[model samples]
Target: MDSLTHLTNNIPWQRLTTAYGRGTDIPQLIETGQYEELSSLIEHQSTLWQTTPWVLMILLQELSKQKPEQVSLQEIQLYTAVASTINVDEMDSQHAVETMNELLDEKYLWPEDEEDDELWWEEEEPRGYDQEAFSSYFSYSYLLLKDAIPVFTAIMEENDKLAPAIQELLLMLQSEGERAVE
Candidate 1:
């Protein structure tokens, strides 16, 4: 089996949180060719989730296996959405993992009762924004996508249909600005 299959089998998708809820259905959705729903679950209003990078990794792996002409429109759109969601111009990939690790160490907190809807409703006040957690989440996902630049680059070269958008993404990642990962 390929690496994507291996990862799909091994990763704890049920424990990963997405916009709506746990990512228990993600692997099944991918297996059933549900790209649109997958897109919605992995990202919401530009926020990436714990599952986003893994999902994208699998999708990219599938894309790599297909002939350029055989790539589906849904797949293209999913990747385009990813490109739009990430502001790679602001990232420092070399240090992203370190920063993510530090932030995660400081800010990784999940409520113990995730499935308790009544408990959620019992909370009178919403939680405050945790910037460190947000930054760590973004940085981790960004690094994962950044590491797939070679795959994206190869697709850009071979798939004329996706080249322009992928080119823009590549440009954003390759920019020399000194901005730290946000």
Candidate 2:
């Protein structure tokens, strides 16, 4: 299968692109020839779902975080490959709600307890998250993540541990401070 097809097999980033949509930067993040940031970010974001979202949570984290720099374009593509839902497509936000609902069901994000031990139990699929949280700002749903990229980009700026290359890229890419956009 083609590489894009392969990446989607496990996470379906293209489906995410089609489902939620993203901005031009989404592609740039994936195609920037950056590997360490993409890989590390993928690991960090993936951990969120390791217990619940499994795949969905990682995608969310990726959308939430900024891509580090001095990596490889292939690596960025790999990261995006796994994303199946987005906050915004090319033109407007779409499938933001459905993607979250599907993620809720697929990853079991909502839990009776915030510290549920068996949250990571293996099964045919995961449980659903709190649907009452379907929103564009407060909620952790796809649409909210997508709609709030500008805010998150601003937040990424003040982060300290970020690599200098990545920091510079963010500043240069309009992904830093208030001017950083969604």
Candidate 3:
């Protein structure tokens, strides 16, 4: 896995949309280890955004590396709470993830190319926050977390205090994964 710095630098934070607005501040906050502010930006009132999964991934990595007693309760709470919001609907997300992956490949999250001399005309379309797209985004976020299950599993084994929460999250992820395939 890439170091948090590498992942933080490589993602197009300016282009990615978060719950509060553009994700321009995310990299700075992450580098500074300001997760409380980070949480507010990616998740709002149980709604997740394009930045949520990526931030959560980074948080998981950081949390798993820390000594169990040193883990931030706030960060753990944020991780599990944000996770509870991921509801993958019946959108064929296996296919959506493929589509999203292709989009990421082509820099779909970046500003679209245009010959417009007008700045307003060149403005990027809003990150699709509509119903279907939101479902797809949720599905995409679910899969990202699903990929990190082992990280949680390892953390569970090492931390007695955190095991119950991590186990609950594992159960949630497992059930969600099963539902995605059904």
Candidate 4:
């Protein structure tokens, strides 16, 4: 438990498997591909907003840079379409999450009583995804991965203290992501 918390405090996503492996010795589950628990564990621990999202984004960015030949078609489209739309360079996770909600999920507070022809609007407000805090959260994640995703990857892969091979597939995907070029 304490070890998991320590691993959670560090981000880039690659370290999760190692953290798990260290605690549990069942590396075969990774080989068998029963990794849903791994994902669930991550999400469960991340209710407070984890930097794994940035790890994902970094992998995407790296993928976009690398093997353009093998990049996911969606990645290409997203990079082409939303790259310019989003101010990623200046985007803080808080603002980004909030903006994401605003642009994607607009919330409308509805009145109790409904009218046939006449419409009643009670309140329309932005469901802020608590944007002020995650800004620094993402910034910290960026700093963690600035060196290379593999820095964390190596740590996870080699750390016998962690479940070592837990996120084997995700690490594989992220490793494949290194194909991006400058």
Q: Each candidate: what lDDT? A: 0.65, 0.34, 0.66, 0.32
On TM-score, the leading prediction is 3
Give the C-alpha lDDT of model 3: 0.66
lDDT of 4 by residue, 1-182 (tens): 44333433333232122212211322233223333433332223323123233333444344434432333333322222222222234543334333322221223212223341132212232121234433433434333334344433443344444323323322332322353531
lDDT of 1 by residue, 1-182 (tens): 96766868876665556777777789888887788899898888987776776687678768667776676667666666666677665554423335433432323423445666445435553121244445556666666667767877777778898887776666655445533432
lDDT of 3 by residue, 1-182 (tens): 55887878877777667766678889888777777888788878888777776676676667667776676556666666677786544435434544544334443463543223245224554434435455556676677677778877777788798888887777666555675775
Global fold similarity of model 4 (TM-score): 0.24
The better candidate by lDDT, 2 or 3, is: 3
**Runs in model 3 with CA error above 4 Å?**
88-95, 99-125, 130-133, 176-182
RMSD of 4: 15.0
Q: Which one wins on lDDT?
A: 3
Query: For model 3, which pairs clash?
Result: none
TM per model? Answer: 0.70, 0.24, 0.70, 0.24
Please give the distance, in angstroms, between residue 33's alpha carbon in candidate 1 and its true position after superposition. 3.1
Query: How many pairs collide in each candidate, listed in order?
Result: 0, 18, 0, 12
> For model 4, what is the error of residue 71's alpha carbon versus the real structure, in angstroms, after optimal superposition?
20
Clashing pairs in 1: none
